[model samples]
Target: MLDVKAQSIANLRAQIKAIEEDSGAHGRSEARSSQCNGNASRAQRPHRRYGTAIDAQRNPASLPCGCSVLANSENDKQRFSQAKQTEEERDQANSAFAKIQRLLCIREHASALLYKRLLASGYEEHIASEAVQRAIDCGLVSDERYADVLVRSRLSQGKGLRGIAFELEQADIDPHNVPAYQEARFRDSGPDELARALSLLAAKPPKAKRVREAAYRKLVQKGYETDVAARAARIFAEQHDSVAIETR
Candidate 1:
């Protein structure tokens, strides 16, 4: 059994030695053939070169295509970045514009009211200001126009001059434009102030004792002048009492 084991060891060594020798001979043969193969490859492909740094002094053409590819890639990257930036800017501007347009469509607004609304809606001050300015430049947002509309509308609802004034002030209107706004929006065509006050009293009686004093207080609360409201209420009560006495 010992001799058998020694023989088996000898056989394994011989096999390993044969493998090494065969590998060495094959490597030598491949080395001798590689020179001819290298020359043939170069002859067939003179323009092509290899390696990470093919633009070496002796291999200029090796990376001409690579250099051009890199340049084109860089230019494309820059152009794409610029396009993205421009699109974002345009989108922001459009968003601001849409918000302003929506508000205007709902109703006319004074410049101050519009600006405050924009700011309250989370718009930046500069953007809101720009939007308001452009609207004004386009004649879309005007304090005077807003005042005129408001005054006329309120007058129809039985609001007196002082009532309209208070409303305009609260809406941040220009006080200087009030007189012009009143003249323009409410012409002298309708019933006089006194007549309107009488009509209001007829429609919605005051909570007072149906006397001039009660009417005067109600008119004052509705934004009438002290003297004008007192006179209107006095005249209205006198005429009403006369009619009642005559009917009785």
Candidate 2:
């Protein structure tokens, strides 16, 4: 009985040792599986430091601290600002052109005059100049034509060539074109200067006691050259004396 009891006690000790070994082995296997699952989860998770996947694709030079996102936003803002400024400039140019058209419709203007008008009406310098150039290109404005018309008008009003030339210069007519217009109108198709001067003197003779001097002064004031004025005065005085003698 004592031997059996000792054998049973030894058997129970062996079974307990076997059970403890199996539990330890199962725990080690479960620990390894848990470690593998954790590694996989970490590998599948996205990195938050680089922003979204799309953002990373767009900016390959992205920094770890996310500075690339700010740079991209700034670049987008700059592009938008440039586009807005371009649109505003285009609108201003169109408005300037419309103003020029209205001014031309009312009456003729020299290119310089038109530009000045636009400035006086508060248009920007570049806008005014562009509008004026457009008008000139489209044949709406012409310095040559303006000069010619002014010369004709002044002549009809009994203004001398020198006076008309000065007026043309003031009106911004080109210096080269001024002489051309003068030669065309006076030398080619207009009345002789001397005849015009004499005719003026005859119509309105001097009433002063010194007739020749007075007539010369009057003709000079009317824009004739001194030489032409003197000759016209002398002829008029002689004609007056002869007429007086005939009446007596």
Candidate 2 lDDT (Cα, whole model)? Answer: 0.76
Worst 10 residues of 2 by lDDT: 59-68
Deviation from native of the Cα of residue 100 in model 1, angstroms: 2.7
- What is every candidate's alpha-carbon RMSD to the true fold? 15.2, 13.8
List pairs with backbone clashes in candidate 1: none
Point to the candidate with the largest TM-score. 1
Q: Could you give candidate 1's per-residue lDDT for residues 1-248 as a string of tens digits?
A: 99999999999999999999999999989987898898898765555544333333334334444464434454445655787888965666567667778888998788887778888987778777888888888787788778877877877878677777777888877555787445733667767677777777777766655778888888888877787788888987897789879999
Where model 1 places Cα greater than 4 Å from the true spot, the runs are 1-93, 178-191, 207-214, 239-248
Q: Alpha carbon lDDT of residue 181, candidate 2?
A: 50
Off by over 4 Å in 2: 1-72, 175-190, 198-248
What is candidate 2's CA lDDT for residue 185?
Answer: 45
State model 1's lDDT. 0.75
